[model samples]
Target: MTVTHALEGDVLRRQDPELADLLLGERERQASTLQLIAAENFTSPAVLAALGSPLANKYAEGYPGARHHGGCEIADVAERLAVERAKALFGAEHANVQAHSGSSAVLAAYAALLRPGDTVLALGLPYGGHLTHGSPANFSGRWFDFVGYGVDAESGLIDHDQVRTLARTRRPKAIVCGSIAYPRHIDYAFFREVADEVGAYLIADAAHPIGLVAGGAAPSPVPYADVVCATTHKVLRGPRGGMILCGAELAERVDRAVFPFTQGGAQMHTIAAKAVAFGEAATEAFAVYTHQVVANARALAAALAAEGLVVTTGGTDTHLITADPAPLGVDGRTARGRLAAAGLVMDCCALPHADLRGLRLGTAAVTTQGMREAEMIRIAAFIGQALRDEASAPRVREQVRDLAGAFPP
Candidate 1:
């Protein structure tokens, strides 16, 4: 079903005009404003249809054929399709698509491999590591002994030497390599080597780059990481959910950890939507889209750097980009507010080695909306204009609205 059918249907509007109006307002906002958030993307209408399908009413509690709920025969088929498609897309020996979100996938990975109190090594939060990697507020940090590695202060890149030193000294039970705000490609092989040296399991929290990996725009972590956790959205352009990939030997352990240990009652509708996304990602057109996403990101990063934002790691190798906007006479938080007022929506992130925050944006959603490098260049200029002159907010908002209309997301 199309978005129009889902949102503009008479049933919802007749039953609750209030909720219908709210949904329509969100739809209008999405179409009118630019979505630059690093973790967001636009899924296909096919994926949306699956999400709103009858499968949503089902309550399958366990894996495929062994589900606890009755009348799940069709749910089993949908889930099996998602699993097989995921396996084929990533060339994984085993795929588990049940986890509710990327954090859930990480929790299950931890459940499958390491016990509570086991020492873990990961990139520090200041260096763009995700909360699941080792945030004090997260379960991973509280349950496990987490040692953090940092990035180079001047270069704004991962300190490989520091990671090795920490791994050898701490001798963690597992080592995770991934980041949310980092722009460069991670060296999965190097991380695998470190894990081998320390006799620790390697978990690649590839929530950000898995989409690029699917389209061959980035290196795959499947071959190196003992357990790979990723979100189906972002550049993947799927419904929002999490998945895990591992070898056949660990499949049962991963499944058990995801279902019985961490979560229950799988969402069959989302599983089916993931299957549609996996199918789309396997196409050559999707590969071209992924490549363009990188190109758009690089162009935008360069343009932003030209505007005096300190482009972290020099530029981006993936869809995501994080840059300190302090050179523009405003901090990241202030810049975010100004940009939002000017119709540019994004997020504020912690800058590596700096006390203040930075602006984090991505091209995934805009790219899915059919924007190219030229639009990215204009977007950077608009951002610059919005930041440089407070009185120009109205004009910048109009320009942003026009640009967003041209893309028609």
Candidate 2:
């Protein structure tokens, strides 16, 4: 059934009309707007069914056949299915499908491998690293000594020379390769080599690209990193959760880290949903979908550049794009506000070497809704128009409404 029809027929609608109205409003908002947010997407109705299933009430607090609670036979089966599917999907020797979110997955990776005060290396926050990578206010930064590497100032790419120099000079205990805003594919092999050189564990936080990896649209870090952390959402098109992948050697450590170390009980429903998503991702149709996601992103990046935005790395190689809207007469923050007003939703992100923030857009959600490269070009145009003139917002909004209505998410 369509999302609108499902919501209308939901038991919540009859039991709690007020709350149901809010849920419907949210559904309407998603269907009516352009979901350019890099971290959001539309999970299939089947995945949604699993998330809203009776498993949500289960309180199984341990691994399969070893739960801390009773009546966990079904929960055990679901979690095991999720674990096996995840391992097969990513080609990892072992998988932990229980971390609550990407940050939690990262935390578990750190917990499994590093000790307090051990030096860790990751991309600097200013260079698109995630907070878990080592923001001073985050636990990663607070508990461990985190050295940061940066991207090249001119090319907007990772500064490999600088990374090597830092690794040799600091000899960190762990090296993390991932980012929240970087649009290029990470060189996991290079990181593995460096980690080996410094006797550091290579932790690949593949949260953003893991979905693309599942669809064979991006490179997988599972073969190189000592531990891989990823979110089930994003391009994976699953529930909002995290999972860890590792070789069999570290499987027991990883499991303990996720359970007693970082998180407690698994969300059986989300795990089941993750399994559904993994199964869907392994299909040939999903492979085509992921390739289209990248194609749409490339088209949008090119279009945004044509409109005078300074596209990061010249363009994108994946489902995400980062660009500065300064040439459009506003900073990233203002550009985001203008875009939102015009029914174009996205995020403001730090530009690698620049002082101003830039816009980060993704094609995963729109592509799921059957939007194509042509739609991306139109979106870039609307973004340019909206950024250039706030007074044109109403007209742009109407146009966006027409475009979005043509492809309901």
Candidate 3:
């Protein structure tokens, strides 16, 4: 049998029957639901298999050729492949494939560049910035003094003028530009200019848009920022892991920070999976996939808005959209729960300086499962029905199952 068949057969015969049942059930649920979680995606079988490989048993406690542990030949190969693929995909001078998650990657970047108590500037959390950017509860905020920039009230979008003004006034060591809820394209070039004028480093958290960048569907921070951190799982469709990419100047510090300062040992299985994911991303089909993700998001946004919901910034330019359900007399939590009951998965998000008027939905997961504009329309209709009358959830749920059946996982 082929490796794929052998793996499948082994999973069926050797895995615990109960756990296997649960896995299959979850797969079915994903395949059937209108998945709209902004931070989730489906990995290819090759990438999935790589993540489950025996490489997971290895312990390579350092960078290639400088490991504290012995017998690292295979681990070295996996790490090297992951690094090379990342550099090729993002056109970076250096890439570190060892961060276990995006948060770790962010931590390593901060650890490498800033001393404790250094001033840092990032978008406010309520405005869609991530916790690692500067939430006081997170290391970035706790260790470094953090100032924030926010979206414009009139446009519901980032105000570059305000960013530059804040950068000049605060003179932070690092200025981060990216968000989880903002549904518009980032102006990386503008950010680069702002950072230069203020003599601050520009760090981009492309955790959500990395797939779009890889597919050439969105602008890349690789060419503009001093450091870029991203997760492999989101739109990149890899294992649950993270990577750090930087220019040649900061290469050594980045590697050391990822090793002794942040992580102990690299996860070889995840590295191998990242390599597979990067390879897949270089293909034309992946570009088409990224385009489809954005298209589906727009279609879904339009449908939701038609149902009297409010879409943040009017619409989306990426695979996710944040909507306001106040017109429907529902809070984000209520809309989320009602939609979940109707078999549509999404998350409730709080927007900055606004009453709890937003629900975040993404198309990456369903798009991965071959969902297109038609499916998004149907899903949006179901969400509308659920919000219109939570009592009609069962009927809408059946429709979701039928739609899911049309595209089995």
lDDT of each: 0.94, 0.93, 0.88
Cand. 1 TM to true fold: 0.99
Candidate 1 stretches greater than 4 Å from native: none
- For model 3, the local distance difference test gives 0.88
Candidate 3: regions farther than 4 A off: 1-15
Pairs of colliding residues, candidate 3: none
- For candidate 3, lDDT tens digit of each residue in 1-409? 1133543456664867676666666766776786789999878889878977999899889988889999998789888988999999999999998999999989999988889998888888989989987887888888998888899887788977889888989999998988888889999999999999988998998999999999988899999999999999988898899999999999999989999988898889889999999999999999999999999999999998998998888999999899988898889988889889999888999876876847998999888878899888888788888998989999999998898878765
lDDT of 1 by residue, 125-145 (tens): 988988888788999888999
Order of quality (lDDT): 1, 2, 3
TM-score of 2: 0.99
Best model per lDDT: 1
Backbone clashes in each candidate structure, one number apiece?
Answer: 0, 0, 0
Task: List CA RMSD, all candidates.
Answer: 0.9, 0.9, 2.1
